[model samples]
Target: MTTGNDTARTTVVVVTWRGREHVTACLDAVAGQTRAHRILVVDNASDDGTAALLAAHPSRPAVTRLGTNLGYAGGLAAALPDVGTEFVAWLNDDAVPAPDWLALLEDALDKDQGAAAASARMETAGGEPISLGVTLTADGHGADTTDTGTETTGVFGFCGGAALLRTEALRRVGGVPAEFFCYYEDTDTSWRLRLGGWTVLPVPDARVVHRHGASSRPGSREFHRWNERNRLYMLIRCAPAGVAARECARFAALTAVLPLRRLAGRNLPPAWNFRTGLRVQVLTEVLTRLIPLTRQRRAITARAVVPRPVVWSSANPPR
Candidate 1:
């Protein structure tokens, strides 16, 4: 079922950490892509035989093995420098895309010269739509957009799970903020793309079924720690001044008040016993890194092609 159009200009980069179970199937799906995408697997120091499996796979995707367990963002950061493709598409090791997934995404970007990235419509194994793109929450956290009705629409961000990014656009934004490690990295980059006057679009026809949390289980302490901390980092680096300041103030206030409320035996938010501690740690970490964060914020501001107000206003456009 190959598309006659040439697709050698695109590279599929899959980042995996201890993903022995799904790497084979993931690669198989990539191999079946209607367009012949060059495949690459970035192994994040997985000692679980995942590296060996990839090496032996018949399709023989080029492998880059990092010595340390740099998270997904780090994995991409490592591989992206070596990627000479016009486009780079990331497919999670645990996700399997439709046969025509790459073809459709490539088509979308080909048609829209202004779009820096195109997000895929992702679903669960049972065919439940899970993510279309990213929508900024009222609290400034990144959440997935689940609108299935749109064929293609402007979005604030792309999900790292399944998205095709223009190589030059990505390099211009500094190639996937490796500082983020994993969580919210894509959203942060999306913000950068928008600020640089590049559009992010959702292409619902390009589909991927992801086994969410296959690498890091949601709600786990590790997940919350990185997720919470990274959200603040992303806001500080990419959000408008008013939005960043307000969210940071609220976070600090919550950190201070939540402990007192618990001591008073007031009913705390469910699952917040640990969250209070997480907030404190996140606040401290952000403060410790404030100098670097401020530098990044200034850098983003200096290179921005679109005004902050305009980017923030379109964060969650009317469906």
Candidate 2:
């Protein structure tokens, strides 16, 4: 199959799972880019006819259909090897970008030689801003800069949903952390990029309207489990030791007091028990992986070009 954009230097990778209703429109918007970029669709084992639809697209995007759902992190990991382009843009199946989305982000990277990634301004369908970029909290959590009410000028991280990244930079950072399965992977990568002396920039003019959580509902138990577990895991792999330790201890304290709070009627019993059980699972998983996680921490520390304090301070400038 002729994977269109033969002369283009960038490929937009859209990862989808059971998103038949959204994938077509997503691909159509990408194929309509004002910039001459290629389209590559990574179908994460979607059983909802998404793969077939991609195969039949007039744009004839290169499609990789995996046998099992590997989530967004794994899909990107699998597709990276075939990117061949100098840059790769990641777009969610539920997002539709303006015609110049890629062009503007490409211009941002072109203008900023030191930047390894550029985040596009993403808004909800109703035009409310969702994220221009991500900012790191002291406790190892990454929040949208828009949500933090902070300056959006130079963000520390880019949202995985709509962003452009240098292909070489991505490979240098050891690629996406497939172990994450989904959440916090981008923040973890951003941390690595900063530690490697690279910056993530925001391209406010490049915009996309995202139907947030279209594939995975935000409040579901699955979402909570992955979000919490991966947040801690990201801290272990990337955050400074002091921050990691403090956050881990805080998580433990929360887990310990949850049952008492449930008994006191501070938290609804059913929800409380479920929350407590998941926290136990997260703690157990982290404990079992401590040895490997520590080794990763050491490896990151050894290669880091920026000071830990500087990295943390950039995200948390004195207000």
Candidate 3:
């Protein structure tokens, strides 16, 4: 979806790494967007010759090749300042969006003056439903909500994998958290935008087909470690004042308990690899930055106009 700018109001950014098989189709689909938009590809040092492939394409999108992989969020963040558009749309190289995907999200954001972002309905390429939108629990556990034919603007956050972001709003909060590097960065950004008094919404009619974990191999030790650790950072860095104490206690307790529980079969998930050292690392990561996170909390506390409860509520308002 486009926001009606004379010279491409939105810059569609696709981040890729050794994604030669998938990037071609993804680029073609992006070129077919119903609305006019610019395209950019940030290559995270793909040895697969993804750059050569892009160079030969008719679209000839501007490409930035990095020396080493910067994970998903880092690659995109690196390209943000030069985006030069009112909005930015992210497409996972593993996902291909429907032609109207950008248009629908653009329309939703245009109509909602306070909304900072809008996400497309995503499903797997095999037609399995992924997420219609999102909502979060009191403890910062995010859940994907399937489309129920009654979808609305409310959502916990846009999955960074595919979504439209308001450029100015994104820059105001210092862009995505690079410390997260990859996983949970979007969740942390969502909390920051909400706390900055902007709503993150969903365009349920806008659709995309995502090949889940195509770039980052699922269940990889690196993936799981970052997954658990970043989730902790997300809650600690942005959980509201009311939810902070409980969320922190739960996070700290789990950081300690996940390792210990692996000692007993009845309490452990079979796949648990017993990374006791990684668990300790996650526990201390936040405590090391207590001063900075507290400063962030204060800024969010003072700027937050929307009550945390209202921003988090899942109850559908009467339509």
**What TM-score do all the candidates reach, one by one?**
0.94, 0.94, 0.87
Q: What is candidate 3's lDDT per residue for 39-98, written digit by digit as tens?
A: 889899999879899888777778888898988888888888778898999889989999
Q: What shift in Å separates residue 310 of candidate 2 from its native position after superposition?
A: 1.5
Computed on alpha carbons, the lDDT of every model, listed in order, comes to: 0.85, 0.85, 0.77
The TM-score of predicted model 1 comes to 0.94
Deviation of model 1 at 126, angstroms: 1.2
Which residue pairs overlap in candidate 1's backbone?
A: none
Model 3 residue 43 CA deviation in Å: 1.1
* Clash count (model 3, backbone only): 2
Model 2 Cα lDDT, one tens digit per residue, 78-161: 889988888998899999999999999898899888999999889988888999888888677888866433234588899999
